[model samples]
Target: MKNLRNALLLKQLYQLKQLGYKYTSVTPYKEDEQHLRLPNTLDSLKKQAMECHLCELSKSRQKVVFGEGDPQADILFIGEGPGTMEDSSGKPFVGRSGELLTKMIENVLLISRSEVYITNIVKCRPPNNATPTPTQAHTCQPYLLKQIELIRPKIIVTLGVTAYHYLTGDDTEISKVRGTLHKQNDYTVIPTYHPSYLLRNPSAKKEVFEDLLKVKELMGK
Candidate 1:
């Protein structure tokens, strides 16, 4: 009974924290500082995201892979979606590819996982790690947009084609998209290679690193 009470109390606290009650920053599932307003906060917002059973990927998912990072972060990195590693771990990009991301983030921004916010276009892991469908993006785009509104990031880094297509509505190849900045609403969106792609084609890391350098310049960090 005590455990149940404590869990309820914690949920209440989280809701309170979400409603502009807290001023400090905090990470989603880690020990870091981030602003309190994020898309996963409002019950209506979460319900909208959770009600999405529009994709086949929803069947196999253990949890909806909503994003994580500083709500008030100056930068945001959007990827394809959770993989086997992220699905099992319930954390974004914590695999061999994640190591490359950590190195790139550190080399570029001088921060660890807890520093920047990370998330995906689709929260659930697609079976066999296939790409998320167009319908999935349609269903999830509003939530992503809401997140952007809540966070208000200055720079948005789209990791590879999946993210690019969702944010920019351009299905063109990533090679053409890399390093170009597109203004959406109030944010500047930058496209780049995903760490997993860099893992497959090591030579592309240089390009990804170069694109990330632009993010560093924007952040001034």
Candidate 2:
């Protein structure tokens, strides 16, 4: 189908973009070969990500921070990208913000942190803890997409405007949709404030609490 071919081309473009290629010509592929391009397993995907040098962030990163948690988790939390602590420790949400997130998960969701998966929009850390540029995010998106496909999480929580915007291609302010439920493909998406935001603006904690409650309700907790 033409639509399928176009979609396949788009995926290849993302891959090329990751490799820091500005432009390239794509040859048509037989449908059978299309599936072979993506790694079929999470381990393989993570391995691919670990060795990735597709974007500028890779130049400054200490580790890939590919993500961690139960392989078949029902919920996945996506943040913007690695911060100073995360960059140094090679883990997601391991800083002050991470501590808050852990408490939110355990206390509000009534689940252990290890029970769910956690990752970021981009695996590498941006210099000076700045937000990832559009090119950087676009390049790393394929990896995240593959992770979602392999993990097949039932719910995806997009933390902050960056995660929400990149995942849904919607630039709406996070406050307006913080606790809203959205159907995206086969998964339920819940947008909420990043824990780092809570650290700076503790007043927002109540709103995040409400959002987590919704997540709990959806999970039948």
lDDT string, candidate 2, 11-62, tens digits: 5676678899886776744576554365779999898889887677889999
lDDT of 1 at 91: 72
Task: Name the regions of candidate 1 deviating beyond 4 angstroms.
Answer: 1-52
Candidate 1 collision pairs = 25-33, 25-34, 25-35, 26-34, 69-117
Alpha-carbon lDDT of model 2: 0.88
Give every collision pair in model 2. Answer: 18-54
Query: How many steric overlaps are in each model, in order?
Result: 5, 1
Position 125, candidate 2: lDDT? 95
Kindly list the per-residue Cα lDDT of model 1 for residues 1-221, writing each as its tens digit: 12223323444455556687775444323222232223355345555556556456778987777776676777888999899988887678888887888888888777776677788887788888888766556555656777777778898889889999978889889998898888888889999999999888999988887898888887787
